[model samples]
Target: MTSSVPVLMYHYISRWKNPIAVSPELFEEHCAAMARNGWRGIGLDDAENFFIQGKPLPDKSILITFDDGFLDNYVYAYPILEKYGHKGTIFAVTGKIEPAAAPRNTLKQVWNNECSADALPRVDQPYVKHELGFDERQDPFLNWEEARLMEKSGVMRVSCHSAWHKSVFISPEYDGFYQPEKRTRTFDRIDSDIIWGLPRFKALPRLANRAFIPSQRLLAAIRELVPQETDAAYAFFAEEANLERLKTLVQGFSKDELGSYEDSMSLQGALRQELSQAKTTIEEELGRPERSLCWPWGAFSPDALSIGKDLGFRCFFTTEMGPNPAGCASRIHRFKAKDKPASWMMMRLQIYSRPWLAKLYSSIRL
Candidate 1:
């Protein structure tokens, strides 16, 4: 039988109790199960050769990936992977990862008796806490020092998840007002300046949408018109009567006062710039060529794929679910690692390792 690898995608190995997060205890259990079952974790390069070049990986080989470069991956996930002798890849937003003088304390330090487990930093801090402020909002992401330590340990590889990992307004159509609560949630996914503007506009992931450059004059006018108080603003937009008022206000603006959308050329150029900058930053900081990219929010277009290929990205991870068989390099499919028991994860791994079974299961599930 031809060899196929199942790619498992994870976001935060934290106790934050979110859909995108798996608790540290469950993550360790998953890793331990894989290790005990004699499953080998493969990196992007190995997966590329197997899928694109028709090279065979060993039986029970899997590709493990973590998105967004959460610090928990370094603190909690890294130690467990090292203990299990499994390798993994982290697709990090290069723009968010700052340089630190030294790596932070991890569970590894606790295990080695260098520090007590209580000394480790907490990963459960929720990002939605507006009181934490913008600077403190960066606490969740991995710094370059931590990334380097993981890469050097031969247990983790850091790659690009795009430079900004943000979304852009795709149209001038106002979807809903960006309330204070919503603003805090978008800090990591949008420009700080734009977030402050509280852009009351519809948007799609940056790579997926052409940039809609809104008129600053109109934005400023809208800012002046809206209530300044957080509760008042939230309530103002929430009332059914105020919806038409907001729409009329936006309609009052002239075409020049509204916004302009990027043409095909401009959109392509933007994608190139974003992807290039990410690749350059990751290579320069990590001291190695970055050959893999996982699209932010799994949002990518044909243009994005072409640009990525031009930029020398060999593997492009997507949220598409299936087994990665031979000749499936451009859109490598991955299964989201759920916050479930080890038995559930092992069962998924077993099913996804076979192309035929994976296809059947996906079709039926869909």
Candidate 2:
């Protein structure tokens, strides 16, 4: 049996309160406690050696990672790691740090750089700019200056989370959650896409296999919900690719044609483009190996993994909680630590990071 090495994940390191937002004071305490106990914090290579190569990590060894590249990471997490003589990895949303730099953008924010990463912006979960609502914009992300400084200082190594960290797949509707925050923003640019997107998108053929969705009726309901989509988009449906594409499923289509199948397909290209660009940008900017990819939203499809692997990304990280044994690179499991005492964190980690213990705990969690 292989040793179960624990990889800890954290999001925000700020005073501002939200789920998964760990405060600076508590973060520092956690790091300091680990340091005092002679725990060794290792890098991505160390984990790869243990999990992929079947080599052993040092006893009391741990790997710490931060997701979404929030400025609070630079402002607080970076400094803490440095103070304790430990190192961690940051899987960043390269696009949120600089919106205009990417080739493709799903959402545009009048990015405010004047604010520092430590200022505690009012950002909530799913911290990427493209996934966020326009009104949720805040100045809580790290700029190049800060990220470069940390990279130079050797406190943390940077890797790509996504170019935009966009939630391209695993939409709310797909999972049957229907949460607004989890709604797909793929067609967000087009007014009609946003005005009447979800109900119409629900009619896509791929999703039809999951459950019995009344496609014609759902399209009809969208017409009533936003009559303008019907009036504006209806006339072109007969001649457009959308009608032909949707005709394979849900025949007798008496509802407003969902605008442009081309538009929806275009969104997928944006996701792949972001994945590729994030690798390129990180390599160009930080001079680090863009070999690792932590899936944004912990969302991965066979297609997503194939795309990343094709691009030379060998190490994959995900939010799926459990101990991953050797040779589990493509679906490496990680769990987040809360804003609690170091002992509290360690206890939770012991329960979740060990395979048998995690299974036992999961069985009794209810």
Candidate 3:
């Protein structure tokens, strides 16, 4: 039996000049390194058994995972994995897939809102930019054909990552009921973090502006509702009771920004249905149900987790980085690789192999 192995998670593997993008050349080199080292790339099930059943994988086994179904994984990572006869798992964001080639603007324009410097409290901008976005329909983020082709290749295994990558807090008004402070603070924290955390903070005024500008209409609604309460206390109470139903929503989004509480829940339900349909399709192709899943952006809450579990998935992946010791949960830890060309992976792999360093990193980060 082989010992536990490192499960590597990736998002985009491309030749972009952005620091976040892992160049094709470097990606190939990393795979080549793994091959030379006699690493046997395994699937999620292999790790599950090793950790849960006390089964050992062949020595040098590694599990490779790609998150969000980026097109770069297909355009860039797929050929390399095939070249090395390596196997990997792709956590598909099912909502991103389209029947035909989607317009380039849809991909890029959706994620394009540069976050505000003083980030506002609203749903994290649901957009992706094309020069900045990976075309899910056209390129690497696999369309139906590419996904089926990859699944048939024997080296690639596909799984789910929710329909829209909705965060754990995505549903209406749930956060205020449980984590109001954390939820409220997200508006400011996201603003400051994105601006200050990035290399060029000053150039990102759009991020601040994008967030702080509240819709003028919601303010008016709030004002009108408050005044009429005294004049028609009974009628106001009736309306206020209905409005209270939107407290969580109002905390998250203005009534004008979002039509009503029911609308929000409807969108969330639609997303869950999309995920269920994608999982069913992927399973049909595999001739077996996909019992595992990965959260998009590693964003999930009890509601999201329940949805995944109810959908019949056995395990889900996360971004908590480190070696998952035997007996560790399947909702495992994975680190982000920023510094690389192999040095970054190698260092972290070494750290994960060392209990002390793993403990140190967790403690410091926590």
Candidate 1 residue-wise lDDT, 1-366, digit = tens: 346789999998988877888998999999999989988787767777886777888889999999988888998989989888899999898888867667888988998999997887767775444552322343467889888888888899989999988888767676555554533352345432352225556777888878788877776876776776766665676676775666677778875568887788888888999999999999989888877889998889899999999999988889878778977889888999999999999999999999999988878876
Which numbered prediction scores highest in lDDT against the true structure?
A: 1
- Clashes (N, CA, C under 3 Å) per candidate: 0, 1, 22
Per-model TM-score versus the true fold: 0.88, 0.67, 0.61
lDDT of 1: 0.81
Name the lDDT value of residue 211 in candidate 3: 21
| Candidate achieving the largest TM-score | 1
RMSD of each: 3.6, 9.3, 13.5
- List the candidate 1 regions with Cα displacement exceeding 4 Å: 128-139, 182-188, 191-199, 223-248, 254-257
Rank candidates by lDDT, best first. 1, 2, 3
Question: Tens digits of per-residue lDDT for model 3 on 191-275?
Answer: 2122100111121111112122223454454444433332243233345464464353355554346322224465457445755
Query: What is the lDDT of every predicted structure here?
Result: 0.81, 0.62, 0.55
Clashes of 1: 0
C-alpha lDDT of residue 261 in model 2:
30
Give me the runs in candidate 3 sitting further than 4 Å from their true place: 1-3, 100-140, 167-275, 354-356
